[model samples]
Target: MISTSKHITVFEHQAIKLNQEIDGVLFDETRLKALQSYYGENGVPYYSLIHNGVRFNEYVGVIQVGETIIEVLPKADNSLKGSNEKKRWRDILIDMLFAVGIFDIHSPSNSSLKLKSNSILDLYFELFIKEVEYLLHNGLVKQYRKKEGNVTALKGNILFGKHIQQNITHQERFYSRYSTYDVEHNLHSILFKTIKLLKQINTNVELHSRIGALLLHFPEMPEIKVSESTFEKLVFNRKTQSYKKAIDISKLLLLKYHPDVSKGRNNVLALMFDMNKLWEQFVFISIRRHKEKQITITAQTSKYFWKPESGYRSKIRPDIVVNKDKADCVVLDTKWKNLNGYNPSPDDLRQMYVYHEYYNAKRVALIYPGTNTSKSSGIYLDPITSKEIDKECSVISLSVEPKIREWQKNIYETFNNWLTFGNDNVQKNKNASL
Candidate 1:
C-alpha cells in the first residue's frame, strides 16, 4: 500500500494500492473522476485503480498530488546511468523547457552544466528562485504609479470625492498620497505567489527550506495568482534588461503548474503538460533554427480547408507547414510516441493524409521520437488511389535519446533537410544548380 509511505517508486506495469483514505486523509472523488476521464482519453492511465491494483501508466516523471507521493521510475537506459545523471537531468529539463516555450532559458551552454543534487522539479524551482534573487540584488525594480486616497498629502492624482467625505476633518493638515511601495512590484508578486505555490505542492525538504529562505527577500507583497498567459506577455526593455531572467523563470513556472481546481475553492497547484503538443512545437522550433533561404516554416497553420463542417466541427490545425515560394511544400505533424505501433498507426497516417489533401502539399509526414525499432528513419509510402496519388507520406523519427549528452548542432539537420528536400521544386532547383 502507498498510503503510509511519503514517497514510493513504481515501474511500468507495476501495481500498487490506493484507497479512498490515503495518508489518513480522504481523497476527493471529483478530482479522481476528472483524472479518470483524462486518463481514459489519454489511453493508459497515469495511475488507475482497478480490482487488480493501482497501475503505473506508460511515461516517466514525478507526480505529486495532495498527500499522495509518486516517484515513477523512468525507462532506464545508458543515458540514465549514474555517470550520465547530469545530462539526463539536463536533457529532460531542456525538453520540458522547450515545451513550455522557455527558449534560450539559459546562456553560455548552461544546459551542459552538471547538477548533482536535486530532483528535476526541485532543481527548476531553485534555479527560478535564484534568477529572481539575482534581479532583486542587482537593484532592478519594477515601478508603476498607483492612484491615491488619503488625508495627509496629495501625491499623484487624489480623488477629491474621497477627500470630501473621509478627509474633510483634516483637509488643511493632510492630503491623499498614492505610494507604490518599493517592495510591492509585479515581478515580486509573481515570485512570491510562485514560491507560496511551490511550498504547497512540493514535498522536498531541501527545496522547501530554500524557498523559505528566498521568501525573506519578498517579505511584504500581495499573494496574487495571475493568469499563466500573462507571464509570456511580459516585456523588459533595454533599461531593465536585468529583469530578463526573472521574466523567463516566471514563464517556466506558469507553464509547469496549472492552477488546481477541486472540491474546496482553496487555490492549490498541479503541474502537467501535453507532451505530444510540446514535442510538436519543439520539433518545429528546433528545425526552424536551421532555416535556409527560399524556404519558410509555419506552425499550427489553419488556413487550409480541412473539412466542410456546419456543426460540432473545428478547423484542422496542422502542426507545421513547410512552404516554398508561397506554395504548400510539406505538412509535418509531430507525435511524442516512441513509434512502437505495428506500422505508423493508421490514425496518425490518416491524419497526415488528411493534412496533405486539405493543404495540397507534395508530402506529409508524422514525426515520432525514434526508439530504434523502425528500420528506416524516413519510411515513405505511396500508391493509394487518391486525387494526389503522387504525393507521399512518411513516418520519420528523431531519436529523443535522453543520452545525446548535449544539444549538438544538426540534431535536427536530417529532419530539416528532409523538410527542405521533401519539396520537389527545391530538389529540382538544387539539381539545376549542380
Candidate 2:
C-alpha cells in the first residue's frame, strides 16, 4: 500500500489501515476483507484482525492476496526509517532462512538474482522451479503403483467380478489390477500440483518461461489432492533421496496455499515462518556447523520432568544442548526478541532454572538476537540463606551481522568463549566470574 503498485512492506506486529491513507502502507478494504475471510476459515496465526486493518504477528514472510503482495519482514531493533531499512531486514530474513537450511542456494542459477528485487514468495517460487528443472534434466524416478482399468492383456491380478461385469461384451478385454513402474506416483503428483500452483499464483515474469518449460518437459502426472498427511507419509531411499529438497519446498508451498473458491479474486499463497522457530534453528545449526569436533550439539532433546498422579508426564526440551567430551553439558534457550533494557520474563528464567536442575548442566544461558554482542551473568539465590548459589545462567547476545557467515562465526566463538569459563579449575574454586 506504499504505492498503488500492489506491493507493500510491513514489519512484524505492524498494521496498515484499510481504505485510508496511513503513514506506512495503505491496505485496501476489499483485500483486507479477503484476507479476513481466509483467516476466519484457515485460523492461521500469521495475522490477526484489527480495527480497520490486519496486524501481522511474529511470522515473517510474503503474503499474496490476489495480485497484491504484503511482505512481512523481521525486526530486531527500533530502526524503521524507509525503504532502505526494509530492504536490509528483508535481506537479513532471507539470509537467516538460507543459513538455517529452510531453502537451498548451494547451486544457484540465474533465478537467484531475482532474490534481491522480488518478495520472499517469488524467491521460493523460483527455488521450486529450479529444483523441478534439475529433476527434469536428471530424469524423474519411477515407482510401482497399482493401476485398475480395462487392459488388453493379463497382468499382476485380475478383477474377475469387474471383468465379467464390464468386459463381458468385449471378449478380448479384461478388467485387471496391475502394478506398473512409472512416473505417475505421489512424488510426481506433488511436484506436478506445485507446478500448476506456481502457474496460477506466480506473478514474476522472469520465472514464467522456466515454469512453462517444466510443464512441457516434466512427465505428465495424474492430478491428486495433497494434504499435510500426504507429505508426512512420504518415504525416500537413495534413489528418491535427490527429490528431498524439491519435495520439501513443494510441501511448504502446497500446504500453505489456499485457493479462493467463493470469490476467486483473493487466492492466498502464504510462505510465512514463525520467527521464534527460525531463530532457534539458526542458532542450533550455526553452532553445530562451526563448533569443535569434540563438541556435540543436540536440539529439542526432551526429558520427562514432571509426572502427574494418573496422566502423562511433562517433558522439558531445551533449544540447544552442547556437550563436550561427554563430561560437560550446556543448555541454551534461543529467543527471537531483542532484550534491550528489559529482563527476561520470570517464566523464561524459571524454565531455564528447571533445565539446569533436570539436565545437571554446567551452564545455561538464554540466547537472543541483538545488535550489540555482550554477555551478562546471573546466579540463582538460596531461598532461605538469601545468598548466591553455584548454579549460573547468562543472557548472551550474538550480534546480528549483515553477513551470515560472519554472524555464524561470532556465534561459534561467543559460545565457545562462554563455555571456556566453566573449564577453569581455579575459577571453579572461587565464585563464578563474569
| Clashes per candidate (backbone, < 3 Å) | 6, 0
Q: Write the per-residue lDDT of candidate 1 for residues 316-415, one digit (tens) a residue.
A: 7889888832565788888765655446776776787777777888777777765452223222244563223344566666655553323323446666
| Tens digits of per-residue lDDT for model 2, 311-397 | 899998899988822548889999999888677888898899998888888889999988788777767777798677888778888
The 0-to-1 C-alpha lDDT of every candidate, in the order given, reads 0.56, 0.83
Q: In terms of lDDT, which candidate is strongest?
A: 2
Error of 1 at 419 (Å): 5.9
TM-score of each: 0.68, 0.89
Best of the candidates, TM-score: 2
RMSD of 1: 7.3
